[model samples]
Structure formats: structure tokens, C-alpha cells
Target chain A: MKLVIAVVQDKDSNRLLNALVEKDFRATKLASTGGFLKAGNTTFLIGVEDAKIPHLLEIIKQNCESRDQLVAPVSPLGGSADSYVPYPVEVQVGGATVFVLPVEQFVQY
Target chain B: MKLVIAVVQDKDSNRLLNALVEKDFRATKLASTGGFLKAGNTTFLIGVEDAKIPHLLEIIKQNCESRDQLVAPVSPLGGSADSYVPYPVEVQVGGATVFVLPVEQFVQY
Candidate 1:
């Protein structure tokens, strides 16, 4: 079995969850913060058979849409204070960052 | 090398984190909910070398202690309503549920 770890924006979480549920997929939702943006996101732990991976990815892609977000970039460390600019920059966000891992075993009680 | 995904109770999270930090292990903390108990829990994503798996497990075991919890059992589904009785049951909870998965690649920006 493959364990699909999907990190998605909070705005698209509900819809993704609904779609997964509708497709008879069981997922564990985790609230996470992005490392770069430090913004709240939802991470889903989905265990599925290997053959169903494409289907799952399609579901995620259909649910999550990339969107533009304005965020102020963090200043570089050890940089001159006068060189720093704190202007909001438009960045593309809101698409799922997914990782597929091989599970050695799975047990439930 | 392995990615240890540990699902632990919230009560043990801080202590576990401290222990990991002291040991110089970097981990990602995620807020999660348990499937069976429907209770809030913490899921830690710890990336470590193969040789350190045992040590990491030791740290998790030391920090997370199993405890008895009073939980209301859900009534049987599709059964007679009169036959169902709800009672608070003493259940063992709070030990880490760990999943060791193989990582194909690791990337950071």
C-alpha cells in the first residue's frame, strides 16, 4: 500500500475532504503550518492500494485550485537593515503538495 | 533512513517534543484528530537515519505514557434502538501509534 501525504491550503480542504469521502476514501486530516509561508494548511493522510493512486491524485487536483496570494517576504538573515524592503508580493499558492511513500506495515485497533 | 509518523495524544506532545529537541531531532508537528476516539491528538513527522530509529522510538516511548480514559461508546449502527445502551467505558489510550515509511526523496526550499 502507498501512503499519500497531501498538504493543501485550508480554503480547499473541505471540498477535498468531501470529494474523498464521496469516493469512499478514508483520510485522516491534520492541521499544519507551511514552512515557508507559516500559513495554516490541511494535511491529509490517505492510505490506499497502489492501483488507486492515479484516481486519488485526480481527485486532489480537481478539488484544489492554484490561487494568487499577497504575502510579505521575510528579510534575509545577516542582511543590512537599510536594504530590506517590506512590500507585499503576489505569490502563487493553494495547490496541493503531495508525497507518496511506501508503507512497511499498517495496524489499527 | 525512515520517516516516522507518530500519532500521539496531546497530553504527551510537549514532553515528547522537548525530548526530541534535546536529542537534536527535528520534527514537524501537526494537529490531528483520532479516528476511533474522535479526540484531538498530535501527529509528528520525524525524519531520521536508519540507525536512529531505535533511539527515536525509545524517546517516544519514554515521553508517551498509556493511561485509562473514560469514553462513551457509540451505539451499534443499524441495530434496534431499544437494544442499544450507552455507557462510559474505561479504555487504554495515549500510547503513540507509529508508522515507519520509506522516503523516496527529501526536498526543502
Candidate 2:
């Protein structure tokens, strides 16, 4: 078995979870945020058989498509506070950061 | 920086998160269920400096305490349907499974 760790935007989590449920793919959802954007995101931990990885990825891809988001710039630490006008920059969001790891042991109990 | 992934019981998550926040540690919370008990659990993804791993663990230990849970036994697939009556079994739950991984890239843009 493999553990699929998928990080997706909050907007996409509901759809993704629904899709996974429809296909009988069980996942654990976690609330997360992007380090850069500081926006809400969701992380899913899915335990699946090896052959189902591609299917799981396909489902995630369909639901978590990347999109442009406007975010205000955060001032750097120790930087001059004066003349710091925040600009809303468009950055790509909604794509997933996935990590697949091998499971040495999976005990239900 | 190291990414600390902690799987804990739902009952303990709020306190754990609060404790971490008090210490200026940022974490991402995920909703999960145990495979055996099918009870709600929470997974926390914390980004921390390596030196503070011990402290983080201590905080987790203080918040997420393991306890016994009563779960109904599930009958095996293809077993006799009429003869199977599930009896409640006491099992341990609520301890955290933590994974510490090295982060090659830590970007805040």
C-alpha cells in the first residue's frame, strides 16, 4: 500500500472529497495554508493499493486545477516599514503538492 | 526546516493546535478517521526548526493522550451472514503517529 499525501486549496477540497467518496477512495482531510499565500488549503491523506495511485492522481487533477489568485504582499522582517504600499499580485494557486510514500506497515488496529 | 506530520485524535486536536499556536508554531490541521475504529482523528502538519522537534513532541505528548475505545468487531468478508454478531472490543486510541521529514526547499513568496 502507498500513502498519498495531497495538498489542495480549500475551494477544491469539497469537490475532491466528494469525488473520492464516489469512487470509494477514503481520505483524511486536513486544514492547511500555503506558506506564500497564507490562504486556507486542505491536505488529504489517502491510503490506497499500489495500482490505484494513477486513478487517485487523475481524480485530484480534475478537481484541483491551478488558478490565479490575488494576494497582498507581506512585508519582510527587519525591512523599513515606511513607504510600504501593499500591492495585490496574482499568483497561481489550487494545484496540489503530492507526496507518495511507501508504507512499511499498515495496521488497522 | 523539518515538516512534522502528526496524526492525533479529534478530541485532542484543539488543545494541541492551541498549544502550538501559543508557542508560535504554525501547523495545518486535517480531518481523518481511524481505519479500525472508524472514529474521527486529526492530522497536523507542522513546519518547525529542527532544534525545536523535541519541544513540539513534548507539546503533542501533553495534549494527545491515548485511551481505550470500544469498537464493534467487523465480520470478515464472505463469512456466514446470519451467524455473525459483532461484540464491542476495547482498543487503544489517541496516541500520535509523527513523521519528521527534511524539507529541501522552504520558500515564502
Candidate 3:
């Protein structure tokens, strides 16, 4: 068995969940924030047999799409606080960052 | 790379985070809940090199420990509501559920 950890934007979370549900795949949702963006996102913990991975990835791919977002850049370290002008830069925000991990054991009571 | 995913009780989260930071290991906190108990918990995503796995696990082991918790059991399915008597059952609540997953790729932008 493998555990698929998909970190997706919050806007795509609901849609992704619905898609997974329709395919009979169960998921555990975790509220997370991106390390770079510091924006809210959803991390899904999905356990599946080895064979179903491709199908699961397809579902995630179809649901989440990358989109441009404007974000203020962080001030440079050791730079004067008053002189720094934060500019809103456009960057891709929406899309799923996925990781597939091998599960040593899974137990439920 | 290995991503150490640890699901721990909310009570032990701060302590665990502090311990990881002291060791210079960065972690991302995710708000999660247990499947069976449906109680709030904290899931940490810690990305580390292959050699540091043992140390990370040790820190988690030392910080989180199992504890007895009294919880009301869920009513039986299809059972009549009027006849059911809710009883508080003692169950082990604390401790970390850890998963170590291999990362195919790691990126930061």
C-alpha cells in the first residue's frame, strides 16, 4: 500500500474531495499552510492499493489547476524596514503538490 | 528525501514543535482529526534527509506519550435512540502516529 499526500490550494480542496469520493476513494483532510506562500491549503491523506495510484493521480490532476496570484514579497533580511517597498508579484498558486509514500503498516480499530 | 508525517494529540503539539525547532529541524503544522475518535489533533510534515530519520523519530517518541482518556462511545447503528445508554469508556488518546514516506522530488520557490 502507498500513502498519497496531496497538498492542494484551499479553493480546489472541495472539488478534489468530491472527485475522490465519486471514485470510491476515502481521504482524510488536514488543514495546512504552504511553506512558501504561507497561505491556507488542504493536505489529503489517502491510502490506496498500489494499482490505484494512477487513477487517483488522474482525479487530483483534473480537479486542481494552477492559477496566477498576486502576493507581496517579504522584506529582505538586514535591509532597512522603512526604505523597502513591497511589490505584488504574480505567481502560480493553484495546483496540487503531491508525494507518494510507502506505508509500513496501517491499522484501524 | 523522507517526509516524516506525525499525527499527534493537540496537547503535545507545541512541545513537539519546540523540540524540533531546537534541533534545527523545520516542520509544517497541519490541523487534523482522528478517524475513529474524531478528535482534534496536529499533523506535522517534517522533511528531512535520509540520515536524520532516527533522530527525528526519537524526538517524536520522547515528546508524545499515550494517555488514558474517557470518551462517550457512539450509539449503535440502526439501534433505537430511546433504549441506548451512553457510557464513558476509557481509551488511550495521546501518542504520535508516525508515517515515513520517501519523497520523489523536493522543491522550494
Candidate 4:
């Protein structure tokens, strides 16, 4: 068995879960937060047979999507109106940031 | 040091983090999944002084406001075109689901 950990944007959790359940796959959901951006995120624990990797990917591909967000640059120039310029930065956020690792053992009792 | 774990919607992660940084708090972000909803969620580990609970809560209250979301009831009626009820159920999603636990030991070297 393999445990797949996927970190995705919160906006897509509902659709993602529904799709998983539809496929008869079970996951353990832990409420989580992101350290980098301090945003709300969901960390999932999924145990499945090695052969099911493709299925998991299919579901992730369908639900977890990436997108862009606008954020202000951390180091904004400090100046009066005459010298100030808004430092607007765009960043890509979302989609699946997943980690697949070998599990030594998995037991549910 | 206390480990404050907050599970929140992905939509609010960025804002939430910004608020924390603004307050000089540092957190660890982990990607997670929900067992019930099978959706995407973020788990955060925030270390703070015990006295900072109220401040943490204030930030959560500001960014993790709950909202209604529409989900389909699991037991969808069969019968193709005739026996059908969309069965749209509105559920509340979002807000901080936090767990504050005492750490037996903490070390950073």
C-alpha cells in the first residue's frame, strides 16, 4: 500500500472529495494550514494499492487546478505620492502539490 | 511552546498567513485532506506563546469566516429521467478548526 499526500487549495476540496468517494476510495482528512502563505489548506492521507496510482492522478487532474493570484511585493517602496510606485506581483497558486512516498506499513484496526 | 493546528479552507490561507506575519507569528504549513468531505484542506502548525491565543483567534475570525456551499446528497435516486431529485444540500464550509495541544517537548537546533 502507498500513502499519497496531496496539498491543494481549499477552494477545490469539495469537488475533489466527491470525486474520490465516487471512485470508492477513502481518505483521512486533517484540517491544516500553510506555513509559507499562512492560508487555509487541507492535508489528505490516502492509502491505496500501488496500481491505483493512475486513478488517484486522474482524480487530482480533474479536480485540483492551479491559478494565479495578485499579491503586493513584500518590500514596497516608501515614498510620498510623487515617488511611490505600487509593486504588484502575480503568483501562481493552486493545483496539487503532492508527495508520494513508500510506506513501510499501514494498518487500520 | 504550543503547537496550534488550524484546519481551514484553502481560500483563506494567504490572507490568514499575511495576518500572522503582520503579527510576527511563524507557522508550519502541511497539505492535508478531510476524511468526511474528501476535499482539499490545509493544516497549519503555529507556535506561539500561550498568551497569544487571543491574537491568533482574532486573525482567524477576520479571515476564516464561514460560508454556505452546495453539495449533492450521497444517496442519489436512480431511474434516469423519471425518479430524480437534484437533492442539493447547502452546507457551511470554512472557518478555523483549531486544535491546541501541549507539546511534551520542542527543540530547534
Instruction: Give the best candidate by DockQ.
Output: 1
Answer with 1 or 4, whichever has the higher TM-score. Answer: 1
Error of 3 at B1 (Å): 2.6
- Local accuracy by lDDT, each model: 0.80, 0.77, 0.79, 0.69
For model 2, the superposed segments whose C-alpha errors exceed 4 Å read A36-38, A68-93, B1-39, B44-109
Q: What C-alpha lDDT, on a 0 to 100 scale, does residue B72 get in candidate 1?
A: 84
In TM-score terms, which candidate is top? 1
Task: Give the per-residue lDDT of model 3 (tens digit) for A1-109.
Answer: 8788887778889999999998999899987864313367888889888899888888887787577788888876898888776887887766766777877898889
Question: Which of the two, 2 or 4, has more lDDT?
Answer: 2
> What's the C-alpha lDDT at position B61 in model 3?
89
Give Cα distance to truth, residue A49, candidate 2, Å.
1.0
Chain A only: give the TM-score of model 3: 0.72
lDDT of 4 by residue, B1-109 (tens): 6666666667777888888988999987776555523246676778877788777777876787677889875654465655555688788777665555555678889
> Which stretches of candidate 4 lie above 4 Å from their native place?
A36-38, A68-93, B1-109
**DockQ of all candidate complexes:** 0.27, 0.11, 0.20, 0.12
| Model 1 alpha-carbon drift over 4 Å, by segment | A21-24, A32-41, A65-94, A104-109, B18-28, B33-37, B54-68, B71-88, B95-97, B103-109
lDDT of 2 at B98: 66
Better of 2 and 3 by DockQ: 3
Please compute and give the TM-score of the first chain of candidate 2 against the native first chain.
0.73
Please provide, for model 2 over B15-35, each residue's C-alpha lDDT reduced to its tens digit, 9 standing for 90 to 100: 999999999999997666543
lDDT of 2 by residue, A2-80 (tens): 7788888887889998899889886777656665234688778887889999999999999987888898988856778
Global local distance difference test of model 1: 0.80
